[model samples]
Target chain A: MTRTSAIFRRELSGYFTTPLAYVFIVIFLVLAGVLAFFVGNFFDRGQADLQSFFVFHPWLYLVLIPALSMRLWAEERKSGTIELFLTLPIRLSEAVIGKFLAAWCFAGIALLLTFPFWITVNVLGDPDNGMILAGYLASWLMAGAVLAIGAAVSAGTKNQVIAFVVTAALVFVLAVAGTPTVLGLLQGWAPSSVIRAVAGASLFGHFTAITRGVVDLRDLVYFLSIMVAFLAANAIIIDLKKAD
Target chain B: MLEIRNLVKKFGPLTAVDDVSFSVPEGEVLGFLGPNGAGKSTTMKMITGFLAPTSGTAVICGHDIEAEPLAAKRRIGYLPEGAPAYPDMTAAEFLDFIAHIRGFHGIEARRRIAYIAELIHVGDVLHQPIETLSKGYRRRVGVAQALLHDPAVLILDEPTDGLDPNQKYEMRGIIRDLSPHKAIVISTHLLEEVEAVCSRAIIIAHGRVLADGTPAELAARSRYHNAVRLDLASDEAAGIAAELQKLPGVASVEAAADSGQATLWVFPQGGQPISDAIVRLARTQGWPVTGLYVERGHLDDVFRTITAPDATGNALRDAA
Candidate 1:
């Protein structure tokens, strides 16, 4: 465990030592802020809630989370640093978990930086801080799920571009799979149960439940399960893929 | 101390290492000699517990690599080939990370980092990113990282691969200094490197141990042991060659003429001493012999003769 923490510190330091962490925070804040004001119509909606802001999270994470995670394992493998990590006395699982946690924490920090919006809502109107907290929790969990998937894809190949593309595509499908916009277009072609199942699997549905202060255990379980499943797959792929 | 018993590694149908076994007594230096692709790196990897072998076992300082990898790894320092490292991190940061994982804390880690930097002569570039350092410095950092934990068994794969002559000499001196209390195995294709640093040499060709003995012992086994070289004056060259070739036990002789001087490379058969026969034959013919010396066959010849027949010889040799 101490070794894992050591690795975590170094991994986080790696993120910050480069321009990556700052670039990510700036881009994430700018994009989230712009969408909240414009497409989300926070002012026009005239609601005390941050429903306008939380609503765009599923779509925002589909692209951005993959970009954040595409370099995790793929870059390590490409640069031959995986050999150094694997040769250490630490267990493979420990290293994987440590690195995953570092990426998650970095993503979470970016998410936390958005709290000024929460403070702004509270200052201007009587917003439900409890619901806003729930929304933040749900959105963070969704990001974790996306990160896991992206990491797994990144482990499958040495090319970060390919990992990013595949992760974006996977997250996009998961986000829109349960949405009415897509179901309405294919309403007559597919059964309602199939549509509902697909829509229910969407990240939006799970996060929406949490945003409404409805902390369904099933939604939480689904997100946790996806994160574990992808990470497990990532480990398996890294073990199987021989270095060139 | 390290012991490997019949260690074998296979990748599907390709056997990278086979039935390789040897033991390194504490404080002994062993040279791992093989051609490119000869399982030197694979054997090192298995010893470090980076790869599991298909058969046999590697016991590092009494700990089995497979069963107790952490314990075994903790006692063994491995310098992998090509010196792989995180490009984004400075040498100091990489060393610090390694020190942290090796259980060095705070002030102790700082002291150890400084010690390693000075030892490997990378102190000047500690703050430079590893990618920005020159190849020689990068390799030094790799060696520094391997030695940071001060393990008992040091497995250095091509430790002097990219070093300049001066750096190579310095590295050789360091290896010699470290050999008194630590067991060291140096894997390299350069025969002179083995001659310079290793007390004993293990030659592997085609994934199998071809020869194992002291450098002098192996050199003495060459078929050219009885051969001699003689330099002759131009007027006496033809007479010497003709006479030497006809002498009893003299099977084949090669003579070359250059710049008014003649040189003869003589091969005497039947285990006969070339000098004894040549002295007798030269005196009889009254040929002036400017120089006469026994010509010891080079280690390179022995290596090429043993490893060239099977290119696969380069891929499956193991050193304990």
Candidate 2:
């Protein structure tokens, strides 16, 4: 565990030493702001809630999370330093968890910097602060889920570009598979319960339920399970690569 | 102490290492000699527990490399083939990371890092990012990293692969200084490097151990009994070859046409000194012997003789 912390500190500092963390924060905040205020029509909707902002998060993360995680393991393998890291006394699972936590924390910071939106809603009207807090929690957890998936894909290869493309495609499919538009198209062929189950499995479905000021244990469990599944797969891939 | 027994590594259908076995006793430097693509790096990786061998075992400090990897790795320090280091971290930071993981703390870790930095002569570049340093300096950092935790065995693969001549010499001196306390294996193609630091040399080819002995012994094992090349100014080179062959212990003679030099392959027949016999023959013939020196055989000749196209080339060359 001490070795894990050492690797975690090094990886976290590495993010700040380069322009990656800064660039990711700026892009995330700007894109979130633009999508919320301009396209989502925060004022035109005249809503006292953050429904407009939360609606666009799935699409935003589908593109942004892969960009943030594409280099995590790919760059290490490309530079031939993965062997050094793996040969250390630390277990592979600890290293994977430490690196994932670093990226997740960096992403959390970017998400938190959107606090101005909370303040803006307060200034304009009386929005439900409780629901807003819930939205932030959901967003943070969803970001972790996306980051974990991206990290697992990243560990599969040495090419960052391919990692980004594959992870983006994967997250995009998972994000939209159970959306209303896709479910509506399948309504005629599938039963309502089947459609509901499919939509229930989508990232947006679970996140939307949480952002509505409801802390569902099932929703939290779902995201946590997905995060663990992907991270475990990542550990397996790293072990296989070392074996090779 | 380390022992590699019947080590074999295969990638699909291609065998990288083939039935290799050797043992490194405590406090002995074994120079691993081979040409490129000779599976030296692969062998080192297996011994360090980084790669698993297909069907063999390596015991390091009484720990099986495959079964007890962490324990085996704790006892071994490895400098990989190209000496790779994380380019983003400073030397001090990298060493600190290694120290922290090796379970050193606070003042102890600091003292160890300082000692290694000064030992490898990389103190000047301690604060700089590893990628910013010169190649020789980076090589020193690689060596420093291997020396950080003070492991019992050190496996250095081409330790001086990319250093300049002066740096190579200095690095050799550092290795020699460390040789008395640690069991070290320095893998390289440079014969002189073996002569400079290691007392024993193992010549490997096609992923198999070809020959193993002390440098002098290996060289002497391939030496012909008084076979000497003479560069003498003589109008009749063939006549000299014929006359020298008639002397005791002179089994055969071969003459080169271009240099007018002849090599007499002697057999130490009847316990006669081949040099005294050649000297008496040369004085009688009035052949001005320009150069006459006993050949101190080299590793190059042994390597070529063992790995050449025909195994009998060495025997035939010795006979004539």
Candidate 3:
């Protein structure tokens, strides 16, 4: 556990040690705000709730989270620091979790910086703060899942750009799995059970369910399971690819 | 103590490290010598648990590397090839991170960082990011990181690779001072390093152990062992060469072209001392011997002889 925290502390401070952290946060904040106010019609929606704000999160994270997680393992391998890191007296799982948590926490910090949108909705009218809180939690959880997938993909290659592109493509499919466009295409030829299963597995579906004010146990489990599954794969990928 | 037994590592169809094995007792410095791509780095990586071997095992402080990697790794302080470290971190922060990971914290960790920084002379660059530091400083920082934990076993791969002469001397002094308490395995292609610091030497070639013994012992295996060279002012170059070759116990003699003097090298038949006999002969012939010295043999000659592809038949077994 101490070793895990040691790695965690290094990775967390690693973000702030460079301008990459500030640049990523600024881009995330600007894009999320712009997409919500200008494109999602947050002010024009007039709904006192942050549905318009939360609606753009999956799309925002589709690009931002990969950028955030691209260096989790890829940079280490590229720089040859993975040799030093793995030779330490720490388990592979601890290092993987520590780095994943650091990236996830960085994403969480970016999400928290969107507090102004929450304040904007609250000051304008009576809004159900419970649903807003749920929206934030769901968004952070979804970001964790995306970052986990990105971390796994990052371990697959030493090139961060490749990690980013592969993760973005994978996350995009997960994000649109439950949308009408995808379901419609599958409806004509696929079985109903297959369609239902695909929708249930979508990140968008689980996140949207929480934003609707009632957090289902299944949705919470789904997000946690995704994080765990991908993080585990991240550890395995690092072990297998470490020699390369 | 560290024991590597029959360690083998194969990367697909290529064997990077063949069944190489050796043991380092406490307070011994074993110099791992080999040519480029000769598996010195690969062997160290497997022992340090950075790479899994295709077969065999390394035991550190009685802990198996593969079965109990954490325990084995805890006993080792490894400086990987190229001395890689997090470039974004400052020297102080990097050492602090290493100390923390090694289970040191607070005042103890701070003291350790300070001690190692001073020991390796990296105090000047403590606050500078590793990337901005010079190559020598970066290498020192890597050394400090490895020594911060002060593990029982020290595996340094080319510790003085990028350092200047002064820094290399200091690094060697530090390693010499620390050798009495730790089992150190330093890998280098530098033959002089083996003589300067290592108490024992292992010569590897083609992913196999070509020879292992003390520096003097390996040097003794050269054909030039106990040979003598003489430079005389006399103009009888061929006559002296013929006389030296005819002398008993003298295997062969070669004379250099005359440049106002004759230079001759007399090789011994069985590692015998021929310098005294040559001195007697020079006195009897009234030839003025301007220069004379017996050769202890050269490690470079032995290294080339054993590592050369066609010289496999002449590879000497370990003298130990």
Candidate 4:
């Protein structure tokens, strides 16, 4: 709807109007490159694929997505623009979805800026471009899921730093829940259904599953469901807290 | 064009807006008056659909705020307290966004943005970031955004809060210009503002309506209504007060010496016209009267007399 686009345009431009967009993009590119080439040992593997570039996306997103989405709602509340925004002739869902789409689009832009990684692999050897493209798709999906979590947490507080820290902590727990160490701790006593539920909620688990060339419907469903569920909660949280 | 019916808002155990209700027809400018924490802003929020009421609802142009918030909101323009706006956005950008959400786009949006900018005197600062603009300009931008669509109902909370005298006067001029076609509700701590623009005034405290009437009607409730103030050059404060008290319609007289001159305030019985009788007495007695005038009462006194000092009175009412 036109109303939603209006909010989307304002929120997206809000990033560029300040140093937030440039600084965030700069940090995102530098960190993603360092993690992929230096820490991730992209050349050391030399398997004619971007396995190194794709492996660190979960860790990359855990920190970067929160930063991108922190000010989406928190700054609005702090600056008192949220009241003006909500009182406009639009539904609460429109504002929520519009702001989320802006933050997600910014994340997509930052992810797209990493195309040199893809280009480097293609020119260096006969890499499976199909697998690399799949990796990018998986990363974008996981980033959307992460940004959704950040948006929900951002709605509950007016402090952007608090939103960032709390979102980081919450997503960190979700990403680590399906690790062998955590599952080992839950085994022998916890029910298998509970363990499966915990594993299904692990963002890194679903993220890693989709990076191996073929996109799975279950993985797509998982990411989309997280987006829908978290965004719905974001709307409700903003409604309860907008009056604050 | 606007009506509120028994609107109540309670925050946990404390009630922020009690059973308060009022309506404003087209062409009427209602001045909402109350001290700090008097539920004026809370009521405005409910009417604007920013906060949901615990009990009642507001109807804007026949659209119930709770039943069809989008419809009601479309018909209302609200300038909240402090005139909050996006700090990072330029004034032009902010208004353009508002115009877009108000359903105008492209050339129509640009045309409206220009017109509202001119009407609000924010033309020069249209490209400046709102945060960088002066307080007066920022407040005008707030008013400009609210006036973008020219809704039937306008709710402005302290529209001229931080402006200078000239800006405040201009702001009042704008309100006077717009009131002929719209219903307006303005909340202020300035009694002079009420006298200048408001057709009717409502005083509230502890989330309850204390008094509602025309500005003159509320002022006439003051005890000083129809009273006379006399400034005499002579220093006989006591003797003249006694003589003035003996006038046929005079209820009581009190005189005080200021800078070696005596000033007397003569109250009339039942607010009768005692000025003629006092003049006759002063002339017959050949008193050294330098200045004399009858008082039409004052809004400040009426407001003070009607509102209690604390929440105890409201709490008592709540208990019953």
**Candidate with best DockQ:** 3
Error of 3 at B271 (Å): 1.9
Give, for candidate 1 chain B, the lowest lDDT window spanning 10 residues: B311-320
CAPRI grade, predicted model 3:
high
lDDT of 1 by residue, B1-320 (tens): 89988999888898889889999987889999988888888888888887778899999889999899899989988888888888889999999999989999899999999998988899999999999998889989999999999989999989999999999999999999999999899999999998899999998856778888888766655556678888887667666677778888888888877788888888878536768878877787677788888856567766776677654333322212
Per-prediction share of native contacts kept: 0.56, 0.54, 0.92, 0.83
Q: Candidate 1 lDDT, tens digit per residue, A1-244?
A: 9899999998888889899999999999989989999999988988888888988888788878999899999898887777778878898778878888899999899999998899888888999888898999998999999999998999888999999999999988888777778888869998988887787787878888898988889999989998999999988888777454
TM-score of predicted chain B, candidate 2: 0.89
Decoy 1 TM-score against native: 0.92
DockQ of each model vs. true complex: 0.66, 0.62, 0.88, 0.86
Which portions of model 1 show Cα errors greater than 4 Å?
A180-200, B257-260, B270-273, B276-288, B310-320
| DockQ of predicted candidate 4 | 0.86
Per residue, candidate 2 scores C-alpha lDDT tens digits across B1-320 of 88989999998898989999999987789999987888888898888877779999999889998888888888888887778788988999999988988888899999999999999999999999998999899889988988889888999989999899999999999988888888899899998998888989887767877778888876665545345666666656677777777776666666654445544344444323477677777788788777665555656776777656485644533442
Error of 4 at A115 (Å): 1.4
Query: CA lDDT of each candidate?
Result: 0.86, 0.84, 0.91, 0.91
lDDT, model 3, position B129: 93
Q: What is candidate 3's lDDT per residue for A36-114, written digit by digit as tens? A: 8999898898889999888889988898889988889889889889999999999999899999888888888888998
Docking quality of model 2: it rates as: medium
Q: Is candidate 1 or candidate 4 better by DockQ?
A: 4
DockQ score for candidate 1: 0.66
* Worst-scoring 10-residue span by lDDT in model 3 chain B: B311-320
lDDT of 4 by residue, B8-124 (tens): 999999999999989999999999999999999999999999999999999999999999999999999999888999999999999999999999999999999999988999999
